[model samples]
Target: MQALPKTRTDGRLPLYARLRDQLASRIANGEWSPGDMIPSENRLAEEYGVALATMRMALKQLVDEGLLERRRGTGTFVKQPAFRADLFRFFHVHDVEDPDGPVIPESRILSRQEVDLPPEVKRAFGDDAGGRCLKLERVRLWAGDPLLFEEIYLRLPDFDGLMSLDPKEMGPLLYPVFLQKFGILISSATDELSFGTATQASAKYLELPANSPVAVIERIARNPVGRIIEYRRVHGRPERFRYRVNLGEQHT
Candidate 1:
């Protein structure tokens, strides 16, 4: 039997809510990884010293929030993000020969260092976040041409030892590294797409003339419990940008 922390010390919070917070913290801390089956509800109920129904309610909340998924004959496992599909949906990279086939661009990490957080980035990570964070500068290339210049920001401590890793080992996608190395599962992201003129730095890396119009994508990525983990701003050549969407039943 385990005791739930009374950090809130509020009598109004339900027992199941406290249990939910504890379980979420365990998941965040990597007690169970993505695709790994969690202990059964009966077992958890015993371990937590809570009623079966109470445990079920707590688990149900996580399931509803997409942190966990249930299998009928099997048990519950942590939900894995569909990164490939999600990436293609946002990046719009594809093979030249097979335009419909999604492809991952070759990535070159320019720099990695600890830096003071930008105002917007700090706000997204919330008030408790440290003033400093890990910042990365990278460029994506395809067909030997620079396609996108990226400025990526990650929360501190959560990604503490990442600076020691060789950039070449990280490859193109960062979400996989987040989960496999740090046990941080990126569940979802919200990207805002807009058209903007390139900055001097963006122009230098993107091989564009000064003030060239570019496709801008600002993304806020979150974990299963909705903690913002990464904030990225990408600028791509407008000519290479493509957006496809299908609406109505016909597309379905």
Candidate 2:
């Protein structure tokens, strides 16, 4: 393996961050490919002439960013690149225009249910699952690899016959199905973004180490009548994905 570039002493950034930046740049330059094992922590420590903890901190940052993946009983490897999505625009994964992007997203249906609504869900739907609600747990993949895990809730009245639809036909997009089946037009939406470590389930789905960092996005889609039609929680691989926002200048 080639030696990592030496760090500059003039910069004020943390040492670990500098190491993380260097590693990322190397990967972008094609020095590392997906599934290729990187040096062990001890080896990196020796190469960088840093303490073990410092090496670990640098690796952890990359793992959180999704650039590197850890396999139990094995070492770290580079990860598959991810698509870049702009936060300011409305997007559905199926409608994405990039041909090189994920064409067929593999999906695993973890659970499906019709049960009494939870308080938070009730607030969003306005009506309890007093009648029924279809709950779906799904993991979405890109290029046949798992990329996201999602939990989606839809009121029963709006999708009375949803169970009859073939899961394979749904792809990674659900909003369009809602529109076709129930005329639930999503007029607007509100989203909240936060950082979190992976849960046991998410770690398994993403094939990542326990406590690996992830990006969490929570969204609520409303219809023209001001009814909350869809509530979704999405867990994304941090390193592979980035959220882009465009800011408009304020008037003087």
Best by TM-score: 1
Tens digits of lDDT, candidate 2, 57-85: 98998788667889899999876543333
The global Cα lDDT (0 to 1) of model 1 is 0.84
Question: Residue 183 of model 1: what lDDT?
Answer: 77
lDDT of 2: 0.68
**Predicted model with the maximum lDDT:** 1
Where does candidate 2 clash, by residue pair?
A: 65-239, 66-239
Model 2, C-alpha of 77: deviation from truth (Å):
52
Score each candidate by Cα lDDT.
Answer: 0.84, 0.68
Q: Could you tally the backbone clashes for each prediction?
A: 0, 2
Q: Write the per-residue lDDT of candidate 1 for residues 1-252, one digit (tens) a residue.
A: 888775345758899988887888777778877788999999999999999999999999999888899999999998876566343354556677898765777889999999999998988888777989999998888777898899999998989979998786687888888887887888778989999999999999999999999999999998755678999988988887788887777743
